[model samples]
Target: MPALIVPTTRLHTAWLEAHDEWGPGSHEDGFGLRPSDEVDSPAGFAAWVARLGRESGQATIEAHRVHCTYRWIVEGDQVLGGIALRHGFNDFVQAAGHVGYGIRPSARRRGLATWALGRILDEARKHGMDQVLIVCAADNIASAKTIERHGGVPEGIRDTHLGPARRYWIKIGRTAT
Candidate 1:
């Protein structure tokens, strides 16, 4: 079974395997990986994990980022994917949504995204969020279904800096069956 755990340096090798599978890009949405992040080395990866921890409790205005929690989807020693739960709303949150996730190509079709989203929703509720927005690429049918399965209500599609995406709103207090 897969579980969501806070990012840690111990998973460095496993995380790199999953990251390699995504090929070369910053598209691993939930990892909160920035272009400046030097995750190739142990020290760099540890620093990145530390930065994520620091961002979890409050917004880092100097970095132009919001408060958010990052969790790795792991099954035993293997890293599968990641999910992010934003604590509050902002222009970026409005466009990107409160949650974002991505499962590695090798791990797709295993319902990992749905499971991770559900877990992250619980985190959002703990953070006192009554509702959360989630957006997926407009063409991503699989992702849409995952959101819908969690009681996500359609909020239409809109163009983002990344491109057009379909948005959904999930009421956090509602049963996320």
Candidate 2:
């Protein structure tokens, strides 16, 4: 079974494999990758991973930044995908949502995204979030469906820096069906 795990240097090679499959782009959402991040070299990857942990450790929101928990989806030693659970809302979170996830192309049809989202929703609840905003590309049918399956209520489509996105809200602190 696939499990959510904290980002680790041990999975560097496996993580790179998944990263390469997405080709070259910052479009690999959920990994919290930025255009300026250099994850190619081992040292660079370690630094990037450290940054992720530091972001999560920031108890207080700073300026535009918010605490965010990052998790990798792994079954055994293979890195299949990643998910992010943002602790609070900000201008960026308003467009991106509190939860973002992506499964590698090879792992897309295995319900990994759905599974990861479910896991992160629990994390959000633990962090005292009453609800979470999740946004996906408006044209992404699979992501929309996955959200809906988890009791997400449609909040309509909105334009973001990344273009048109479908927004959803999932309530926490309640018994899940």
Candidate 3:
């Protein structure tokens, strides 16, 4: 089975390779973008990752280290996609979740999202999140289905800074692993 690999400094080359494949318009590319445009390289990503680790403790943003960033790599070699898990509060309840994921465009419709999210949900439980709030765009039917498949229960939908988002909650022990 494919496993979730945490991103690390040693995998910078892999990250670079994936970034090149996905390019700037992809959601994965958004992770590399910053306000100052200074974070534009491997070294910059490493620094940014380190900074996010530090900031996660002080700020409400629970963005974890890449080691904590879960990925679904087939045969443990091909990185299909991943979920960026960041801890959250009230705002996150309405918009963001503890996790955000995307499959490579070429790898879509292959059940990677369901697998990746199932793994991330396990990680959330390991991190002491008894209940997780997962939100996706109301219009994102695919994502909604993935969420539902993973046992997410519709809590409500709300408007946020980005747009309309549907919020779902999963109680860790309620579902069998």
Best lDDT among the predictions, by candidate number: 1
Q: Write the per-residue lDDT of candidate 2 for residues 5-65, one digit (tens) a residue.
A: 8888889999999999988754777787777778889999988888888445322234458
lDDT of 2: 0.85
Candidate 3 residue lDDT tens string, 101-154: 777667779888888788778767766667777888889899999989988999
Model 3: residues with Cα > 4 Å off, grouped in runs = 29-40, 52-76, 174-177
lDDT for residue 60 in candidate 3, whole number 0-100: 28
TM-score of 1: 0.92
Worst 10 residues of 1 by lDDT: 54-63
Q: State every prediction's TM-score relative to the real structure.
A: 0.92, 0.92, 0.73
Per-candidate count of clashing residue pairs (backbone under 3 Å): 0, 0, 1
| Residue pairs whose backbone atoms clash in candidate 1 | none
* Overall lDDT per candidate, in order of appearance: 0.87, 0.85, 0.63
